[model samples]
Target: MHIFLHQFADNAAFNLRRLLCAALLACSVMTGCARYVDKPIDAHASSLLAPLDPQQISADTKAHPSTLLPVLDIDPTGPWNDMQIGLIAVLTNPGLKAARAQGGIAEAQVFAAGLLPDLQIGISADHPDSVGVVNAYGISAGFDIAALLLHSATRAKAKAAAAEVQKNIAWQEWTVANQARLLARRLPFLQQQQALATDAENTAQNLLGLTTQNVDAGNAKLDDLALRRVALLDTTERAHTLARDIETTRLSLNQTLGATPEQRLPFAAKSIARDFSTLDANSLFETARSERLDLRALRDGYQSQQAETRHAILAQYPMPVLTLNRARDTTPIYSKGASVALTLPLWNRNRGAIAVAEATREQLRIEYESRLHETRAEIATQLTELQRIATQSELLRQQLQQMQPEIQALNNAVQRGDVALVTYETARAAHLDKQIAALALAQAAAEGEVTLELTVGVLLWQ
Candidate 1:
């Protein structure tokens, strides 16, 4: 009995030593595993308040090619035209930066998806409470065969998703840049309107003062004095309204450029660089249908959905987990074998997932078609409106020119005391009104140009 007990103790000690070796190896492996470090977020905002120097941006862009869409060779200190301002907005806009960061995560996801999963390892231990029994243990090593089969489709989907994300980010950057361009174009026109309104206001104030003097002397009718006061009020309101619009547009432009609200820019008088009068709307829409970043992103999204659908369909097949194991039991029997755990396509068969994936693909198809139609219609509408503005602007310019001779005649007549001062003032204010209208049309044309560029996803401006 003592001999048997010593033999059992010897077997137990051997098993215990084997278990200790396994534990030591596991510890060694865990030492090479990933460790986490604390990462804290900053409480304060890290917004860049001041703009980068233009020359430095130009230099940097030259040294390391700019990734900006619709890249331009911009002279920063030169005229801040629509394209130049747009480039600036793309460079500095906070929203675009955040979007690009999201795109980076998408790219990283592609890398992760391409990686092969690690082999699974499992260990089991059993202890016997009575004598004539030894310690038992099992060790298994293998992988999910189903995951290996689906890897190609999964990686393709991730790649397509990453491409879609990047294209969408580019589209967003284009939109923000165009917004800044529109406001920059608008600011100058608002300033011009204010100047014209100021001239009219000055003329009306003089006329009102003269009319009041004549009324006090019983030389002017009360109705004429009332007319002069009304004219002065109209001019004053116009000036104030234009001034307010200017300030508002300035603030908006600064915000789009990622600058402080009160920041000032050297706004140029002429904002439009290229003419769309020659380009047919139909032709432009055709080009945009293929070239627009958003549309391209939709195609990429559709491709990714296709991949997802394929993956789901592939999943309907039986998934298998293959493992090879070596074990020793409490009876002192040793074993080694390979086994497979297969998931049968019973009632489920991954039908729900397949259906969902196909439905999602169909939804993306519908969305892309709808967006295409909207894009075409908007291009046509904006182009037609821009043409109308140009026509109106031309007509107004002709009218102003036609009035120039009469205005000169009125000036001479007033100097000779043959025309009333109020009459000359009325003619001057009317000319100013036409000038303001012309400026409005011009500003609308500039803004429309930017919108069209954004819609078409091409730089029409040189």
Candidate 2:
């Protein structure tokens, strides 16, 4: 009898140890299945600003159809138009690319939020020697119903945030497009201005040389020579200033097109004359209110915050988790049951979170209204400026028309030596300057038109 009792005790101890080991293994498997992945930083990520490859953009477009474009479909090479330049900037601008990545992150979070929670299992064992009980183990699977209840709201918020990102990107694209159009329109005038400045410099240099020769030959006074030299210096300085201005303008245009500074672009298109005769202020106001991308983003953000606030209010209640449990003991005693755990809301009722969410929602509401007012004001301002510029441009055009015949007569007389060459050159330079001013005004009006279209979220120019 004693030997049998001892063997029974030894077997019980061994079974207890096995049960403990099995419990530990189950826990380890449940928790350690997902390993950490090391994401090594790429050393070449700084090369994003390198010249864009059409093929790479195409491949990326295929990978992330929503985030990028097939630039290869467009003429990725030379002579990019306004829309093409905007597209290239959208595809290749580092800031916009990063914004696209951030939107993807929000989309991924929405996907994650919509997913059902993972099943949970619990294991327990009792030592027979200490507790005088048989070896036992229990497994439980459960999920948080509170999380399930909040899933819709969470997913809505995530999706709204993603929409906001897209709208923000559209606004950014509009800004780049406006800048590109303006600069491209201004390019010809800038080139013409530089050329005129160069001509003036050359004429002044020639006059200075003639005056110096006359002075040396005792045919002109020293005062005349001094005056000619001063004129040459002034014209040279003006030429140098204009050259710098042309270089700077080219650089800006290249940057807007996402090209290298040295890259030559086709800017031969004349200044665009946008007709505003059909534009009604009231209609434009309504359009801006309805279609503005930034305003749409603000609305999206407000919707997201509303959902978050709802979720926060709902979360103040008890978070109940339902568990399905199974247990087995060494003595063939098996059990199956269901249980529930509740998070009592006695201490923290989420009041602070609710307050914060409510305040944020109100703030967004006011912000939306404020932005609406600002949008209207901005559209009005642009319209007024465009009108003013249009009037000035028309008057300048008339002036140019009136001056052309006089200038031609002057040119003919100078060719026949009836008038001084210097006098004719001065008149020609004045006319060219007027032309440049008119072109600059047209470019400004074009930019205003772009801004108005961007505000209304449509291509009015087309």
Candidate 3:
């Protein structure tokens, strides 16, 4: 009984040890799983709170502040003033370069067209007595005159078309460059307005701070502070909007200048000076009619079409063919002779070609008329816009002059604390609004003036 009891006690001890080991293994597994889950969560939280790198912060701080462009030193006595940037662009543009190359091609075509038909030569050998012997060797020369005549007219039309294409290309390049210069000039003024908006925002913030201080000192109500804060926020947002617009304009101007957006450019604030020297609109229109390259190109096209129609009608009468042939033969019978050949106009008269050419000439005439009418209408519309904007600009200038003293008085009153905060704020806002409006009016007037100058071929920029 004692042995059995001892064995039972040993068995009980072994079971207790096994239970303790199992419990320890389970605890270890659960602790490892908990640690694995917590690791990712902790890492994510740390990443969220990570501070910005000092190097990046310093680099950003060192970036240059945006600045207004400086004025360019344009030569007053140079031919550059007489010619607009448009003319320069036309001279330097790649499209015009390609068009000019077409002139060389047209010249080559003339050579091809005027070439006389190639002479034909033939040689024959015969064997008479089992040994090869030169029985007959002949050379013949012949040409068709009709082919040359047709080619000459075609070459002339090609040359005329090439010339018109070159002129049209030049006109297009000039228009694009003119528009670019105008846009570049306007960009600086837009930037100036953006800066003004920034100043207004800063002023609003300063006023808000002052109001907050007054409220803290029991000199102003909480509502007054809140109102000033709201105003400041509104002004700040306006400044931001204006700044964004200015950036967009700047990028567009840069693109026009053929520069990357990151590249810096200097474009001065430019205003169109009123030309005390004014020419009659009718006179200007006449000058444009004579000087405009696109119009001249169209006229050239019409003349070419007329020439083509005449050539095609002439083609209906089969061109008389004149051929000269010379042949030499030796061996079986020796013969040498020169003969002239001619073809009668019998079956094929170019009636279809004549009809097509006449129809094309009519189409060209219609196109020319349409282009002229459109150009004249454009000129009239641009002139009217220029006049209207000029009148509006003068009125705005007068209004600004009249408001100057009043704005100054209001500014002084606010600085002296004689005006209520809300009254001062409102007056300041009005002044700023008027200034922005005046600037916009001025810009529109300048644009219109430039457009008129372009339409009339009056050079505006040096």
Top candidate (TM-score)? 1
For residue 223, model 2's alpha carbon misses the true position, in angstroms, by 9.4
Q: In candidate 1, residue 264 scores what lDDT?
A: 67
Residue pairs of candidate 3 with colliding backbone atoms: none
Candidate 3 Cα errors over 4 Å, as ranges: 1-134, 147-155, 202-257, 275-280, 320-331, 335-348, 458-462
Q: Against the hidden true structure, what lDDT does model 2 obtain?
A: 0.72
lDDT of 1 by residue, 23-67 (tens): 568667876866898765553355355555677656644554435
Write candidate 3's Cα lDDT for 51-141 as tens digits.
3233332233234211111122233232222122233333333454566576677667656656667544333322233333332333344
User: How close is every model to the real structure, measured as TM-score?
Assistant: 0.90, 0.80, 0.67
Residue 120 C-alpha lDDT in model 2: 69
Taking all chains together, the TM-score of candidate 1 against the true structure is 0.90
Q: Top model by lDDT, which number? A: 1
Error of 3 at 438 (Å): 1.9
Best of the two (2, 3) by lDDT: 2
Estimate, for each residue in 136-180, the C-alpha lDDT of model 2 and write its tens digit. 556677888888888888888888878887787766766666666
